[model samples]
Target: MLIDIKGVLNLWGSFVRFTDCKGYPTMQAFMRESPQEREKQRYLPRLDDDTLAKVDRQIRKLDPAGKAKAYLANLAKPNDKREELESLESDELQFAILYLRYVAGLENKPIWQKLSLSKGAFENELRLAERFVEGVLIGSEIRLFL
Candidate 1:
């Protein structure tokens, strides 16, 4: 996989096919990777603009004693990164899903009004979802995904 925005969007279904870690049996399993392992992997995608690249991705060895501390610190990440999408309100989440599944790619509009989505609301939630997914992709760790 290219690990770009399109690649991240393609990872919508349950399983992430390109990584070693398989289905997320437990979120803990995803977060339990050792710092050495983390240092050995490239988590985020390579930025297109070299000037915008992250400098702190350099290898670093943290003390083994701080494993718990590190785990506690990064408790939010997981194999399935739906936390942001799940955080949306019920109606917003519904509209976001409907828009992505049914409306986003079509250049023609036929039964769009049947969805009964308010223009302002649908577009608002759609943009919000877009930003949320982008943030998730930006922070995602490739090795931790399954």
Candidate 2:
């Protein structure tokens, strides 16, 4: 087929702009990532078993009982913020605190300090609390925002 440079190419035929039917960017001109997003990706923390379960025994004990039944029973008055925290078990409450801290834009070290937990303990409880919360949410048929 004879190629027509007139319509297919722009800017002195230097680039085709897009590679395919998808209108994905092929332009050298790129969009700038928002500061919030760039910062999010950079500091995204990774968790490993050693960090979460420092004790071998705790690793085994850290099983989350996935009982979706009797869900929101954990907090009878879900709207009552203080009561909700009071209703949660220590581990769950700790995780909740960490989440609240994150929302407040606190970094890892400071957030851990606010919870009065060392790094390993914080990560460990966070995992367990996560599981418990999952069960409760599933039982209540409430979806997590994530």
lDDT of each: 0.34, 0.35
Q: Could you report the Cα RMSD, in angstroms, for every candidate shown? A: 14.1, 21.4
lDDT of 2 at 118: 91
Across 1-146, the per-residue lDDT of candidate 2 in tens digits comes to 22221121121111111111244454466774333211111111222222222221221222234211122233333455423222345644444443333323355576556555698876676556445544543454432221
Per residue, candidate 1 scores C-alpha lDDT tens digits across 1-146 of: 22343333333211112222343454575565443221223333443222112211210111123332233223336637423221334433443343334333332132123334566665665455455544544454422221
Clashes of each: 1, 0
Model 2 / residue 67 / CA error / Å: 25
What lDDT does model 2 reach? Answer: 0.35
Identify the runs in model 2 with alpha carbons over 4 angstroms from their true place: 1-92, 143-146
Off by over 4 Å in 1: 1-7, 10-114, 143-146
Minimal lDDT window, size 10, model 1: 55-64
- Residue 55 lDDT, candidate 1, scale 0-100: 15
TM-score of candidate 1 versus the correct structure, residues matched by position: 0.31
lDDT of 1: 0.34
Candidate 2: RMSD over Cα atoms? 21.4
